[model samples]
Target: MKTIERRSTCPINYSVEIFGDKWMLLLLRDLMFNGKNSFLEFKASDEKISSAVLTEKLNTLLNEGIVTKITSPKNASKFLYMLTEKGIELVPFMVEFLNWGSRYNPNGGPKTLLEKIEKNKKKAIAELQDNLRSQRHSYTNNPSDAF
Candidate 1:
């Protein structure tokens, strides 16, 4: 019998190790698609994630360098969490998952985005990347400029 060494440096495995959980992906989906930033927004999503679980997922994402928490300029008491470049890079994985779900589940999500993604995956990825890049730049230049 031959034993294979697990590669720790593989990017795919690293991503999976950090964000393979169901709720983590859902949280990222909320950030990516819905443009949610606040804790209340995340909690009040269609998925209805609990407060405690949401906190845990957010912390995990932050620790994994997938998400960053920024203090709200308008309200000093609140924090707005946004995805990092690494997190934005998960768009393709999200699209593929949505595609698979739509195919098997038959009533997964909005057919328009899924259809658009299926038809032109490159365009979809590009749009997502562009959006993330612009948002990140704007946020960095002016912390108040967030979607």
Candidate 2:
């Protein structure tokens, strides 16, 4: 019998450490799908994350370099959060989750998105990245569009 050792400290384990929590993925999902980018927006999610939990997750994501907060020019007191490249790179993981859920759960979610993902996995991921890049550029050039 042979025993296997982790390769380079387990990349999946490291990611899971940062985002394996119940709501962390949901937070990422909202950012990826619904374009949510603020404390208030995340709080207003249909899943109804509590304020404390949301705060903790947001802080954790920030500390992990997956997200960054920029002060809103229109409102000095408010901040707009966005995914870093590291974060946006998780699209495949999210897509896989959606595909798995669509297969196993099959109760909710946009069947159209799921079908697109299923039918054209590569194109779907590419479109997601392109959209994120466009959104980032738009938000930076026109901060008001951050909403």
Candidate 3:
């Protein structure tokens, strides 16, 4: 992972430095929930991120070891992105963010998943984390799932 200079020693400051940008969190959300991998898929997101910004954000994630890029076996010209173990660790945080959004914003999160999270927070988080791990491992080994 590439290290960036810290503005302060505070953990919150460190976190904000990495995730303060809305785009980064949205990208993480898409990776965690939306089954998006290729650049084209990301560009197709409802938020409509521009090509330059998407490339920059993806590169930042790659530099931070929060995401990995792999060549698509099905199409040599394309690539797929997956979260790393470090990135997978953010699943709980993402869930809480979703829950927060569901509570505070009119249309911020998916209702069904938010209900699941509310019902059993730990189980829901674990299930999400496990799902991400399974996806990453499957991609690494076989990539039978779509790119």
Candidate 4:
């Protein structure tokens, strides 16, 4: 596999090189938060990402093995995109970002989400991780559907 040449071996630099884009993070947000499995669904996000940009970000994540695109079993013409095991493992980190943003930003997101994160921080992360981990069960939305 090809690797990105960077200035140093710092872990933060490596993480940024792989996932620094705002749009890509939004796509992951949609997948992990909104249960968006379709291109249309991703495109319909509040951020309104352009088709070209979305395609590029998806390809990058796909290349990094952070996500997988599989043909929809219910409809061959469609595709379902989900986080890979590696991506699923990022749930806690992502949740931490959410927590950080809610803390610093004056205008917070959903109150329910904030309250849950505050009230049962560990439990919330565990539940989310459990959901994404279950995606290995072939072609089933059973994992993310509960969210």
Candidate 5:
């Protein structure tokens, strides 16, 4: 991990420094919800992040101990990204963030998911966090496989 400069010792400032950018959150969102693992999958997201930017952000995530890269078992040439325990802990925050976004953005986000989250926030967060932690390196999109 590279040395990071801090503006202050505030936790809020620390979070902002780590995840203030849209790209970082989007990358995490894709990883958590979309079951995206490879660089190509991230590149093909609706956000259309550039390769250079994606590489830089992914490296930053690696350095921050939030994400880890693994050699894909099926493809020697490709690498798959997985969330660390630290990253899995962010599941609650992400669930709330998604709820907030879905509340304001009428056309965005999954309505069914939003309803489930609204119905039981704690259960939703717990289920997601458990799923992320249990999956480890398996980034399958199938709910049965992941859960």
Candidate 6:
């Protein structure tokens, strides 16, 4: 694990330390929603991430245990990346992020869905988390069960 300085000891400060960047969120977005697993697919994102930066961010997530890398069974030379339980737990945060950006950015996609979520934020978040749990095979236990 990497050690670093903190601006303060607040939980928000820790969040900023871990994910307060354009690249991390975008990379995570691809994995969470787009179902992108390969390096080439992530590189092909609309954000146009540079290869070197992508490599660095992937490594960071790996180090944090937020993502796992598996050797492709079909192709020895390829690797697949997927979110771990920790990463999947960020769905609600991402939804809020979507809500905020959609409110300010006219070109944001899924306008209707965002409006529905905006009206019923709690319900939307719960539904999304449940959806993610169902989709992830590794989730032997429901995450919501923990809370």
Among these predictions, the greatest lDDT belongs to 3
Better of 4 and 6 by TM-score: 4
Regions of candidate 4 where Cα sits further than 4 Å from its true position: 1-7, 135-147
Between candidates 1 and 3, the one scoring higher on lDDT is 3
TM-score, per-candidate, Cα-based: 0.83, 0.86, 0.91, 0.85, 0.89, 0.77
Model 4 whole-model lDDT (C-alpha atoms): 0.79
The lDDT values for all models are 0.79, 0.82, 0.88, 0.79, 0.85, 0.77
**Candidate 3 displacement at residue 28 in angstroms:** 0.4
Candidate 3 residue 18 Cα shift, in angstroms, is 1.2
TM-score of 1: 0.83
Candidate 5 positional error at 91, Å: 0.8
Query: Given candidate 4, what's the lDDT at residue 27?
Result: 81
**What's the lDDT for residue 37 in model 1?**
78
TM-score, structure 4 vs. true: 0.85
**Clash number by candidate, in order:** 0, 0, 0, 0, 0, 0
Better of 3 and 5 by TM-score: 3
Residue-by-residue lDDT tens digits, candidate 4, 22-102: 987788788787778788899888888999988888887888899898777766787778899888888888888888988
lDDT of 6 by residue, 24-126 (tens): 9998888766768779999999889999999988988888888888665556698878677798889878887887887789788586667769789888877
Residues 1-147 of candidate 3 have per-residue lDDT tens digits of 556788999999988988889899999999998888889999999999999999988988898889999988788899889999999999999988888888889766776788888899999889988999898888889766644
The numbered model that scores best in TM-score is 3
Deviation of model 3 at 21, angstroms: 0.6
The lowest-lDDT stretch of 10 consecutive residues in candidate 2 is 1-10
How much is 49 displaced in model 1, in angstroms? 1.7
| Candidate 1 lDDT tens digits, 14-84 | 66776678898888788887778789999888888888889888888887777888777778899878889
Candidate order (TM-score): 3, 5, 2, 4, 1, 6
Could you give the C-alpha RMSD of every candidate to the true structure, in order shown?
5.6, 6.2, 1.8, 3.2, 3.6, 5.5
